[model samples]
Target: MPAWTDRALLCLLLAAPAGLFLGCSEGTGAEDVGIVCDPGEGQMCTCASGLGSVAWCRIDGTGFLPCECEAGDEGFGGETAGDGDGDGDGDTGDGDGDGDTGDGDGETGDGDTGDGDADTGDGDGDGDPILDQACYPGPNDDYSVCFPIVVPAPLPAGYDYPAPYQGNPNYRAPVRYLDLDAIDQSAQVAANFTLDEFAQSWKGRYAVLQPHAVAYVQDLRDVVGPISVNSGYRPPAYNAMVGGAGSSRHIYGDGFDLDPIEVPLATLEAACSNNAGFLVEYESHVHCDWRNVDVDVGFFGLPNGDAPNELPLLAASLEQDPHTGHWSAPASGFDEGEPVRRWTAFAADDRVLTQARGRTFEAPPETAYVEVLVGARMRLVGEPLSRRE
Candidate 1:
């Protein structure tokens, strides 16, 4: 191999841990899960609802589902399998109406708030662990306990999923997970999809966290209408072809495609440019992502690279709702009624920080953000949808 190739190889090896430590690259599913989840091209996946319910074992498979949790069942983010008949069909569940209980802080789904168990199948009586050895995910990562808190991603042992992506102790400095589940899935995300969640193992460990792309969509859509994910979560092989950065954030483990209806691309870029400081941010919609830096910054411009000191735009908080009316943003930032000032693009989760050039962006695939907010508004789900609406 050439010297550069050798150097690149070294970077992959060195960066692997760095990426993990920086709060990226956690993978999907537990090796214990006997199912394979294949979220097709540009798709991400999570497990069945009841499987992750408080003190339950979730069956894993490639499919879309809302883990069925009772009014108080808790979850540990482990995909569970529910069979009402106990026939291994992976179907059949307890008719508890508490919405997606798998995202809660309790481990047993009993709504007990105690450190619960994850082994819903070990025959340890109720399969509820005593919440012992339970440590919360640190700061700068997902603010939820239901996400990747980093458990050392060891290299894969044969064909199994890699380990959970661990973050850099130096920068991400370990912190306590706020909610027991570690994830705040309750945010009012977009129209169709709940916040897009992913389970990936990097360096050889499993971590449950949100993709930057999804986060970006959720944020932008909060002010706009439906923000579709034109693209999301690509395997390493695919990211290279898309022309990710030298330190491609995707390979480092998080990038996305966002489509917000209200904010113009320039305005979206400017607002998100400074938010990448949250290591959990994903980038790569039509245009976004943070540069690996210690400082902070932001910027805005057209997809073609034209930006003025002030641009026109508007943004809505989760407080409003698409169900009630269309989302809107500030129009005073740009010249009155200038078509060019419309929000044409945006960055994914953590990208768009420090305002770096040379990134990929695109339009959305769906306009279901309105429905997503509506779902939250009804308080049918565990998250505080009212805040998002």
Candidate 2:
């Protein structure tokens, strides 16, 4: 009825959406005034002695309804439920009644069978839940039961000896040199073999075991019950001392001369033909290495249980963009809906330099190599890239 109320109603009519009313009022009392609003619109306001609450516009678009505070609001209308015992039973007191079970003993009130044990059902009488078998701590603190190969720092004395071994321009030493002193010889590197079994007996202090090579041996073990590692890593100097080939895979840390314990030598050699990149048959043992095989991006960090063919294939290749000089990893062989690319750059010393979530990466200065992992099942290591100036 007031002049200001008429103006308010006119404003609301202009602002209301299609099919919405413009004006509303209470009964014809002296204090009653016209209110303008859009139906179903909400606004925040003070209520219940200045507590925050929300008021919604009436369906008729006339006035704002009274503010209603939520049930949990302090000093508001609704009653706050008491903090019951967290036993998850439907009670709210110390006793096992049907009411709210406040923090009480581990009785029926707490959803326990009065056994004082929580509902974890671990069976150990402790309330803790049992972890998955896969989550149990392993010898290597990794998913695999095998221990990780340790590569010691500060190259040992006489590591690059015999001058010619290091003087050859084409000669490249093993990327990873195991520190026998730091390794647990008794620790399992596979199901049957120990780290000590792989150490170079000539030095007894340093060794190498390429993960893929180790994986190959494990695959052989799966086919045959168990195998023996007669020879594993051989340092360049040791290789020469033992009349090993100048380019022997042992110097690279991937070669192994294995003898099957349960199967015939011929059967073990046959298995190596399918699993190894190269194999040489001898009267006593069969020599195998992954030197000629393409990198198995998926097999590097995984547990050594599955055969090479059973593992996922991630045939990724690194290419440099001539225009931008950035490296991009394009890959295939992943299962449907399974591609999640991650790129990592490593320095010459095997230190991680940087990582990218995408397929393309801008190599940092002094980047030695790039690797790409697709999901958790596939991985590919790119060929060593030329160092950037």
Candidate 3:
């Protein structure tokens, strides 16, 4: 499979009307030609009656074959003598033949509601609104039609995020990804999310609602006031493609990368410190995740243990472990008289060290300080976990 980042690629049940029935059209052989099945009172059934014509069974099972309604004869099914069933009544009648007029008039009395077109049910003879028509071939068919109620406009202000689509207005917009297929599979998106704002993707496309994570977000929102979501709920394939850890919490819908647009990075970090199960600082974003795992407060270069809040030396050297291929070093390279901060490396590329720890140690080779703060505390204070990378 192609990497997630390389391609970043790719990517209703309605109820039928009551008493309505549909049957498979039998072959056109004489023995197979049965009487048109009536759809019954207040119901209708349509079928292909001619090359380009339609047949309808109206109220009281009076079936009408397609008509041209021109200035000529009955043109359609208005056969004057019998229903072609050889009963000899020409019209659909009770066969009483006392000059009954074949109108079926009184049959519209108490049986029909308004204009006496019993088929209209609330009968103005208009039938139901075209959009309001219930499932045509019953709700289970592949082609059932329905007019769903759409709540539009301000209700869903953002086209990107899923928090709003999850049906809770209180949750902010820009949820990154919403799994709509998951909704169809379960017939409902998790109770917390709605189906509208969801977008399509390649695989494992769904959002999960972990209450603790939600609460942590709520807390951050409370302090920072509407943080924008940068990333959330990555499919495992996507996570890997994007250079995320194979076991990233995001794969499980438990992590969030938020944009500190309206608040200071320090403020956001402080908020995370107070609420998150795991808090990490990245180059351009802050990562927070909630899980029941026991871990300490991870402070990523946030000036822990007498460390200065100032930026580290830009050209500082780093050391890399040949065996594990990991890097570790202090935040600052200056000696005793200079402002120095220790580094506990989490993840490192040839140029940048990613995670933070309490004490200074050996840094990764071929790396330079990028001033990126990505700190992660595992199950205890000062001890950071590097698995997030």
Candidate 4:
């Protein structure tokens, strides 16, 4: 027997766990020496070589298990199952066993067991316990996994829905909601304003509220009595359909197009002028919102639904409606028209002209401007300029 052959057998015996003697020579049955061959599903079979080495291969339902050694150690006078060059250190094996440099791990898959660079070759990646799994795409893309979306909770009490949005499917945020049509009268949101009256005609399915804006409405009610809302919380789709402002605060559930049901429009406008928040008085209705920023208040009349005949030189508070052919004024309306005249007019000392480019023309130091428009559509022409004395 070669001296190296004796050393190889000794190494295999030492490496075996417990008192199991994996070293072998001749026809020693694997089961006789307690070598188990129970390769379960999705697993490969492994066998010990004649020289105490191992061989690993996938068991593809063939019922063919590697239970015996191929041969003893070549130089030791027996055929060895390991393809190693017979010194039996298990190094440089035929790439089929759990030798130090063998290809197989003596298990299924790649066959390499708990040895260096000898894995099941399953692409488990580094075999690290923390990161052995495959990569996952994400909740949005991966439909196989269930992911939860965060939404505001604690919806308002007694708020029922129509057939479609009932029970709040798809997990959308819910605030206070009121359906005037479904609910009874006398349950007024304010004086002369009931959910059945003002909110009953709301086109949108939901009516959310920002607490601050609600408080503003309450305050306005104290001064001007009952107020009616023409428009309130509008969904993005509905807002776009109705040609609402692209950046309208109504979409954010904090704005309202309102009108005085009992009090005069001027009285409501005057009350808004003395308070905080945004207020814009149109010909009929008053647009109010709780922006919580600088208090911006303005007044403009929509006498007709047509473009202004003459564009104002200094007073540029005239705008044309593309759909209705009506001329109206909105916040930042001056920037839309071309400056036709640059005249001065007598204005109150406290009057402030808000114009394009955030420019403020004061009445005391600067003259107030009044522009008059003529014609059917009120298209502003360059020829005539109206100045107020």
Candidate 5:
């Protein structure tokens, strides 16, 4: 017989009858004589459990092998594998599949096992995050304390001043009150004045100090030098105890009777004229109040003594959206004359989080406070909305 090649021998074996069984190679058998598919080809098939599986052709280019089901075949029924809800349905709980505590609402949970609630403690239910309510540091490296922006109705028992003073617009109730017992008495409220210095001779520990008054004193200090606060906030009862004028500005928390230490009294009077809203020249001291001044009450200093003239103070009322929890300022009538130039957001540690040019500011996540710089000179700080848990 002629010397046959491997290809010819395989063709002869494939041409034999079905009854003539013969094994060719390790991967080929007599049952593989008829071509079922190309070699190494694969197709989808149903397994014994009615689940889809993969089947590949034999190496000899004949019939396909048995369908092979992959691991985790139970999860192929419209669910993810390793989902540990104990139900094996793959629908409840968070998609992380770790099986931690969740709300089981088919949405991703924060592991608190409760529905989405803000817990901000503002009683508004607006869903804003809690913030730090501590006293923030000021620009002069001093501590700046604040009170809640909302004024209480039916003024506190001892705070309602007597008579015609109550009807006067300038003698209206304070925006908020501060508890002296809870605050540090030695805290530097301004560049040159301490909280104790301002609270001296006051009627009670609970008092109010207008921020504009502090800014005015700081401005005078910049112009002259170290000055002394002879008198600061004097509530109605304290004013009467000292035989003060019935309409004294001291009761308003914006008046300061200051005595200069080094500079001449005339120089202090001149500085007060340039910075104060109302000025009274006394023999040994000068009484100044910012009741008529239109400036940024929240700001501490006027750089280089350059205060904006006729500029209105920026309003601090922030309206919050009930659904979105975003804050927006009211339309300042000064939009045509002195528009808001910048909006800034700050964290609890006084970190600058974001800045924008629009009047509306959406605080970033974990923001503690928001402020706006208006007319390029005035800065108004909004009230802290939430308290940290």
Candidate 6:
């Protein structure tokens, strides 16, 4: 090697070591590097071991210090934690295990790590609102029963009867009526009552007051007798057998028949006036309900003219005709030759009374007699009438 080259190489090696030593030399030694970081200098330095990395420290306390450069791809950069120790237990679950916070129930899931307590006394089933475990809101209204009175808005035209009112529970009548007092049903439900005893006990005259007819009679009381119940839940087939095959509503639980007492249907209707939905008379009986129809049934004269409408059933006029259990309704407009009888017991006040029937199998033109039921209202109508339109 040339003499000049050797000297230059030796000088370069020595300088490189000197630079490294100075840069990495800041130590915790008290007297060591008084080199402090100075903001004015816009530069600072840190120790190689990162002894005081909080920031902006220096060697001589004020002059511009060299910048310490750490490796480029370092993962973490921060002050190492002190040796301080707290409770060693790393259990991080909430007090309770319900997965809920604060309202500790004591159940803890390491993965689901939460307090799992369920019964929180909150109406919502969750202890806390934010942590409410319940999904749906509770029912604010009734969840269990049909109210004592089932009412639909926009009442129907006539009375809406659910099933035959098992009648008021407290109601009872005479032996002639049913001997309710004799049978002592003031407190009982199904008395050992027979159809005959039920019949002989009829103060209301008609046998429709038979079986259940008697029970219905008790409902009328001194108000009147022969207060027959013509149609008390008859099946659809019976209405069909009786020529009601066309518009029979017996299929639905919402149908019933009304039998007039002594007056004419016109009088009963006139009494109702504009409120005529409840007093509609068909060939057989008065159709009293609350729902109105698009077409009035009066044209067929079921409520008035006999024109082959339905029947004109009479409570007092019932005979032991061979049709014992089943009796045919009389034609509209009684035959002039046929005897016309007057029922007084079922009549009272300025008002008249009548029986309730199912369907009538006659046409119109015949003047149907009057059958007025007392207490014009109060009858409860159940389900909708079958759409027999």
Better of 2 and 4 by lDDT: 2
Q: How high is the CA lDDT of each candidate model?
A: 0.27, 0.46, 0.34, 0.34, 0.47, 0.24
Off by over 4 Å in 4: 1-192, 195-202, 293-389
The digit string of per-residue lDDT tens for model 5 on 1-389 reads 11111211110011122221222322223344454344333344333355433333333342333233333222111112223233322322222322221223322233222233312111111211211122322345333343332223444555666443323334444534556666676877666667777775246756667655676788888889999988887877777677666556676677877888899876887888777456554434567777564322111111111222332233445565656766676544231222444678888899999888665667787778788755333466764455423
Clashing pairs in 5: none
Better TM-score candidate (3, 6): 3
As a whole number from 0 to 100, the lDDT of residue 109 in candidate 2 is 37
Which of the predicted structures, 1 or 3, would earn the higher TM-score when compared with the native? 3
| Regions more than 4 Å wrong, model 1 | 1-192, 195-208, 211-216, 277-285, 290-389
Compare candidates 1 and 3 on lDDT and give the better one. 3
Cα error of candidate 2 at position 134, Å: 19
Q: In order, how many clashes per candidate?
A: 99, 14, 25, 30, 0, 76
Q: What is the lDDT of residue 68 in candidate 5?
A: 31
What is the TM-score of each predicted model, taking all chains together? Answer: 0.27, 0.36, 0.31, 0.33, 0.40, 0.20
User: Model 1 scores what on Cα lDDT?
Assistant: 0.27
Candidate 2 stretches with Cα past 4 Å from truth are 1-154, 161-171, 200-204, 294-389
- Cα lDDT tens digits, model 4, 83-131, are 3443323322433444432333443324333333431322111211111
Q: After superposition, which runs of candidate 5 have C-alpha atoms over 4 Å from their true positions?
A: 1-157, 162-168, 294-389
Q: Identify the leading candidate in terms of lDDT.
A: 5
Report the C-alpha lDDT of model 1 over 1-389, residue by residue, as the tens digit.
01111101110001132221111122334232433332110111112343322221122222212222332342222223333222222222222312222322212243332112332222111222211121112222232322323222242232122221232211121121112134444432223444333222221132222233344444554545555555443333444455532233333223444445666554554455555522221223343333232210000000111112221122223222235432322222111111111122222342222211211112232222221111011111111223345
How far off is residue 28 in model 4, in Å?
A: 84
Off by over 4 Å in 3: 1-179, 182-203, 293-389
Residue-level lDDT tens digits of model 6 in 184-227: 22221112222333222222221112212222223332233232
- Candidates ranked by TM-score, best first? 5, 2, 4, 3, 1, 6
Tens digit of per-residue lDDT, candidate 3, span 1-389: 10111100100011233422322222222232332323211112211232111122232222321221112222122323223222213222222221111223323332432223432232111222111111111122221221122112232221233322123222222222333343343222222222221223343444433323544565576678767766766655556667665345555455777767677876887888787455665546677776332111110000111212231122333344456644443333221112222353333453335445433344444333323222432221122223324
How many steric clashes does model 3 contain? 25
lDDT of 2 at 168: 30
